[model samples]
Target: MIKNVEIRQALPADAPAIEALYPAAFPDEDLVPLVRDLQELAAISFVGLANNGLVAHAAFTPCSLAGRGDNVALLGPVAVAPDRQRQGIGSALLRAGLRHLQNAGTGWVFVLGDPGYYGCLGFKPDDDVRPPYRLPEEWRGAWQSLSLSEHKTPLRDQLTVPQAWRRQALWTPYGL
Candidate 1:
């Protein structure tokens, strides 16, 4: 982990820095545009800053189940500066983002990512709420959820993500 790393909400002024981060953080993937779209759409994002500059970013946005009233959100496109990967910065920033969501009373959050990584963060395989698109069988376990509510039960309905996350491409694990 980087010492003295500060975690805070990403601001409009940090847009350029965040834009610069994804390319370096995810060299094999083109995530700059995704992050840009999410930010422009007002996703709740958090940034980790060190003495060097912006080193990490994670975003969250509202999602809901059809015909149900629930406070749900989606976590995605998390990036850590390539040099900072696996050093705990990603997890720290994500935890910070989750804390913000919990404080805002978000009932549930879902993500499609490495089960091992997200599992360590308290996410569990989510069987109740289905993704906007069916995941490949291999990735079924990667589609996970974390309950922020005391009830800890899914709405038992389909998930609806934000506009920036509606793409079928994002729902699949192919590009990663």
Candidate 2:
């Protein structure tokens, strides 16, 4: 557990700390572009700080379902300081960010993460709904969603990937 952790919206000043945590948490890939995308698309960014230094971060990006459209959000890039793993910092950051987005009028939120973790947070897969982006088979069951709106609506028959993200091969069928 961190000695003095605080959860709050991420600021421009937190970029460096956020950047540093990414490589430490994900050394297999360069995440600069993903980070930029999150900053550009998120309705809000959140961070956890300890001793005035960032220890965890998460982002909630604006998203929408095409055709049977509804305002939605995407959660991503949640990271915690390696030393602080399993300390509940990631959960705190996610809960705070989700609450903020819901209060700000986001109708739903989606995430591509471990279902076991997100399930505890009220996320579930819309097996009845399909997304345009072909997620990996293993991920299909993990592509969970949560609705914040009091009156739930049927999920769109199909989901649509943002045009910018559609080009990624990871979203293609074989790759998926």
Cα RMSD (Å) per model? 1.7, 3.2
Per-model TM-score versus the true fold? 0.93, 0.85
**Lowest summed-lDDT stretch of 10 residues in model 1?**
167-176
Question: What lDDT, from 0 to 1, does candidate 1 have?
Answer: 0.86
Residues 1-176, model 2: lDDT tens digits:
23578998988888888888888876765665677666665437899998878889887767667644567877776788889888889988888888888888888888766788889899997675666567767778677789888988867656565543454543432212
- Over 69-150, each residue of candidate 1 has an lDDT whose tens digit, in order, gives 6799989888888887888899999999999999999999989898889999999998888988988777889988999888
**Alpha-carbon RMSD, candidate 1:** 1.7
Give the distance in Å from residue 31's predicted Cα in candidate 2 to where it truly belongs.
Answer: 2.2
**Cα error of candidate 1 at position 144, Å:** 0.2
Alpha-carbon error at 131 in model 1, in Å?
A: 0.4
